[model samples]
Target: MLRAGDTLVIWRLDRLGRSLKDLIAWVGWLKERKIGLRSLHEAMDTTTPAGKLTFHVFGALAEFERARIRDRTQDGLAAVRARSRKGGRRPVLNVDKHALAVKLYNEREMPIVKICRTMELSKPTLYSYVRAANGVTDGPPAT
Candidate 1:
């Protein structure tokens, strides 16, 4: 139960909920009951007008920080792509191994599982090579 004198403490605004709607509802409910809400990390206390303004300012700052982070990450990825540097996981099967696997599978009608076992590869790796040989641009077919 909540009352006017009680204080609701949270580590951070994000820790309270995943969505804006949920956060707004919770904050509104506390405000209606004249209860104070405090965030330790953000130093936001929703009791005085200044505290309320602080909370809103923090929310805006958090949103700005998130956007900046995402922008930086995308820029980093683009730079890597431009340099032709590998971004994600390196394929286990190189060009030679892929050609060999495709040839063995197509000409001999070798079972996929057996081929994977023989090549000491997982099913996904075998599929990736076969897909690459077929001129599929998208990284490996789904296993």
Candidate 2:
């Protein structure tokens, strides 16, 4: 239950919910209870008709912004795919380097730290290459 003068605080509207239907339901519930909802960053309040209208406008704007972001992300991914470019961080170890690193670790009795230092890689990166060479489908286990 809510009452007048009670402040309902939210970090952001996005944190409240992702969809317009959810937002409307929450706002409607607050309105029914006479609760004043406020978003710290967005400076929205639902205690007045003007405030309620502003919240609706804000929700619409947020939805539009989310759609635009999703569109741009898809477009970027498509462009990269068209160009045959891989997304995400490039692997630090190529096949030859990975093979050599693994051999040195397994056959030459090289320490993991030494191998990582020689290959100018972090421990995790060196371990991943070693694991791959060992026919382990999964990369280095999560820390």
Error at 140, model 2, angstroms: 37
Off by over 4 Å in 2: 1-6, 32-34, 85-143
TM-score of each prediction: 0.42, 0.49
Q: Write the per-residue lDDT of candidate 2 for residues 5-100, one digit (tens) a residue.
A: 587898787666565666787777776667788888788887777878888888877777777888898899899989999766777877788788
lDDT by residue (1-143, candidate 1, tens digit) is: 76888999999876664444445667787877788899999888888888888877776666566668778988998999999986777777777877888888888688888888888898877776778778776421122
The local distance difference test score of each candidate is 0.76, 0.76
Candidate RMSDs in order? 13.0, 11.4
Clashing pairs in 1: none
RMSD of 2: 11.4
Model 1 stretches astray by more than 4 angstroms: 1-6, 13-26, 29-35, 83-143
lDDT computed for candidate 2: 0.76
